[model samples]
Target: MFQKGDYTLEIKFQGDMTKKIVGVYRASYFDKLANETRYVVSTKFQPTDARRAFPCFDEPGFKSTFSLRVVRPRNLTCISNMPIHSEELNTPEPGYTTVFFEKSVPMVTYLAPQYVVVSSTHKYHIPLAKQAPNVEYAASIAPKMVEFYEDYFQVKYPLPKLDIIGIPEFISGAMEH
Candidate 1:
């Protein structure tokens, strides 16, 4: 039996990073600059895939805010639902960097992604070096699209930033988060 009161719960668990293109997975692409295959870690949590990454309510109606931190190789970058708040380099471990992201607004589990990527440079959108030129058209056009939508819908975008990434091994044509 229980009374009406406040409660807190904590759970710790780990999940495997898979080679498939769903959930938390690794993908590889040829690097023309380095002449080798490089791998990146990314996520696709739409339509109920978030449970595979971590323990969660895993339902559309179970909305909650999240603050995320990730440790990755010094050569890569991490992106989450919110902008980065701080980054610690080579402290917890050598050759590894820890990134902390800001707390997210209340959102469904599917929108809270833990996306990490590998790139040669921290340029716009972090596309592979070879594909950088191709991003120019999209970069120029995106603001117009956003402006059109904002004008048509008369509602501002809820997030501070919108990151559009290109996944070479993605299974779906597009995903909002």
Candidate 2:
């Protein structure tokens, strides 16, 4: 939707267990544009498609504010739209995970990408995972999922914390969150 080198802010909102499960992801212009730039100098993205990249009503006229947090393992470094804010080690079963929370990005629902993953969930140290996934491949070929996505996305991750969770029941392969 945007070209690389272009800058855009995103505040993601999900209706998960938390009413406003939000995270701030950073987006930049890619050398390529999917359809057209909504804004001229800088676009105001409100995508109709599923990307919902950010938060928005898509009702034509609206204004909103947002907040974000990224969680992962302490040792596993994360990348967001911007640099990280804080990193906290958490245990209590979900130990091996780090809690990363960041500020908000400015964008529409359709255009914002609130969900991001720079690596595999097992990489973050899922002590309770029962069995840590052997990415022997995804890890060996590309040790850092964050770096892979950063290149794949053509945009830098735009938040403080980058959370990667593994869904054992997901399709036979890896799934991003």
Query: TM-score for all predictions?
Result: 0.87, 0.32
Regions more than 4 Å wrong, model 1: 1-6, 119-121, 124-133
- Residue-by-residue lDDT tens digits, candidate 2, 1-177: 766795666644663221121223322222122332211011123224222333346642443334445565544444433335565567423555544445556544433433344332333533334344553344554437677888998987654454333322122232222
Q: In angstroms, give how far residue 44 of model 2 lies from its true place.
A: 15
Please, what are the lDDT tens digits per residue for candidate 1 over residues 5-84?
A: 98766778897788987678889988665678878788878778888888898899999788787888887777775899
Highest TM-score: which candidate? 1
- Please give the CA lDDT of all the candidate structures: 0.78, 0.40
lDDT of model 1, residue 150: 92
Candidate with best lDDT = 1
Report the error of model 1 at residue 84, Å.
0.5
